[model samples]
Target: MSRIILHAGMHKTGTSSIQAMLNSNRDSLRNNDWEYVFLPKDAKAAYGYIHSSPDSCTYSEAKKELEGIISGSDCKNFIFSSEDMTAALQSEDLWVSKGERVSQLFESLGNIEVLIYYRRQDSFYESAFQQRAKEGVPLNFKETLKRLPIMSSMDWYSKFKFFESCFSDSKFTYISYEKAYGGIGITGSFLKYASLNDIIPIDHSKSDNASSKILTKIFAEYGPILDPHDQSLLSDVLCEYERAGDFRRYRLLSLEDRLSVFENYYQSNRNLYSICENADVVDLDIWRADLLNEYSNDYRNAVDDKDIIIDLLKLISATQK
Candidate 1:
């Protein structure tokens, strides 16, 4: 029986880069005695989503699907990476909790190892908002926050218990995603985790998982701030930014607000650290983090135009079916 390694995602904690690296280096990884299973990017077939569902049948279905994947593979080491798998690991669903999903789905597989990355809850959701924006959600920072499921309520203790139930705590390679705490980039850091460092060295700059120039450009100019009242103007800016990749000073969030986010999730995170030995919940007291906008003051000096507002009610009368 070959060993199985799973990378369950704490979304927005650099899972994309890790998955991209594993995908691009699949052939090389196989040469090194590891095979990374490819799953559909989205929807029901996506085991990540199914494994976390409260529906019991989904687990059995996932188990069947997984067995099919493994039966076809000849490699001794198999890798399954999905951020969706841990979506609500801390929450208990009526039918099945996320941890129980893992337990039921892989109960027959025997021994397994898991790799997970933990990020400050506030910081994780902040990055997550930007990701949705890139996908054309047309929502500002705060709007996205309201639309997202409650993240601050997530219980890390339950999450840690969930993974440990499926795969023993000792088999997890938990990494904290704080730079000062030795949070290196995925490709740069995970080779040693997978024991593939001796066989293949990676140049992450070329990894498929890296963020796009349009996004990087936007991040450099503005942080996450957007004008919701100026929908037309904001839309125009959004379109042009994607097409032209322009640079400007944008507001990501306020220092006070960011701190509040840290404070809000602080106790819950501490609870996680107390239960899980594999992860080091960040020490926010001394940990300094980055903001999206560097020139927040510059934007404050600018004025807004009230006349530019376009009333959709008025536009409704201007058009006819």
Candidate 2:
């Protein structure tokens, strides 16, 4: 049976890691009879086609393109991933309510599996806020957490529920973001479940990119705080970076600020975990401590030979190229 796997990210839960892995190893994945459809190369092309024609990009039209791609490919397993899907959850309108767009998409697939990876709320929220900060929109942890509803206006649970309502629970598998450490294990699980293990070789070297939290904090604090006009400019630059496959450095919060932020995240995640008992929530403090230890010991030890600032410049160059 043909299978469709949808890896809908909850954001900041190593979604980029997964996307990078898929992109860097597309050929191998395809050889294993599994096709990963990224936007523009896959679904994004359909989204663009729909946006351009307006009328031609209807749910039916988009579904036809997706079906054609899947059917024409030799792969029996299809994988689609996008963090944008998370926005669908917080939407006021259900997937069905948004015309027949979602329904058509689902109907086009033979066997569909929805995959989600959620982090403890605090960690997810803090990381998300820090991301916004790097974009020059600084919001303290408390304020950012307060805006969770607005951030997730699409009703986070609704997106998954939409699929669940249409498909069985067996068709959905939610993993913990914590399990995504080092990237290989998560990809292995995905391959195993997709039954493409025979085709796709698990390459650990491909998962070499690292987002320096230290650099991220610096950018968050010092990057130009963008207003409307500035934001547009920054967005353009970031888009270019994305196209060039270069990762940007994020600003960091001060030591005091970092601790404050962590505290807020800890409290908030504890509450969220209490309410969402079904979620596989990992403790943020534990993860944070582990990262700290790794950075202080392993990362520093490895890079001790080079000047930290010079190394950062090298990273920037490598990413841009």
Candidate 3:
């Protein structure tokens, strides 16, 4: 029977890089008997079906659209990826039914490999928030704390259990963001998972631009005042100032708060370790050690007042020019 590799990403875990690699190597993957499946219509329609209500007309339309993609594919084996599927895990009210609906979409494929790459809850929260902050949204530290549980609640066991309950024949494989993202990086890690590393040469040159925590804090604090065009210009300037790494890292949560957040999901994480394939891959020890040692020191809680004023003036001057 042909197989399906469903890379249902827990977002902010290098999902884009993996998808880019698949798109870049489409011909090679096709030659290897594995086709990367992309929904012909709105790419997000696949995720829309998962969140759409069964009572609504959208649910049926989305289901039919998704099913069409699978049935229409010329290749018997496929690799489908969508990070937005992770959003269902956060919806306690809908995850089970959503999982069931999704399982039906893939029932024709006899063998299913559910691939997930997860980061520690605290780091995941910060990284997710930074993405929003960069989009000119105001950041609230207290609100960030309140949102911590939502992140922690997305524990490995619960997510895998959702799949197990929904798809009886599916096999689960979970990898930590730290481990999978090593010298070879997440794209390479995924290639290794598909057993294509040796045959598929990896291009190590592509990488995400360096993001400065200092600029992130500035965006969070001053985003609303800037016009959309100015914000776009500032974003370009940020990329040019990638060397701003010398500045103190902007932190939303203190070491104490971050540890508290991690501990909230500690037991559930440990429980997952027991049942997870190659439990050693989820290295909580190294993660905790880095938190307590390398990241324990107090860091800038906000962008420096002087620096912020200077940066804003510079932005204004550049935009006015």
Predicted structure with the largest TM-score when compared to the true one:
3
lDDT for predicted candidate 3 compared with the true structure = 0.69
Which candidate gets the maximum lDDT versus the true structure?
3
lDDT (Cα, 0-100) at 107 in candidate 3: 66
Q: What tens digits encode model 3's per-residue C-alpha lDDT throughout 35-63?
A: 88653224345555666744433655666
* Model 2 score (lDDT): 0.56
Clash count of each predicted structure: 3, 25, 0
Residue 95 in model 3: lDDT: 76
lDDT of 1 at 98: 52
Where in model 2 is the C-alpha error above 4 Å? 44-56, 94-100, 138-142, 147-163, 166-170, 182-189, 192-198, 203-211, 216-321
Measured over all alpha carbons after superposition, the RMSD of each candidate to the real structure, in angstroms, is: 7.0, 7.7, 4.2
> CA lDDT, every prediction?
0.58, 0.56, 0.69
By TM-score, how accurate is candidate 2?
Answer: 0.61
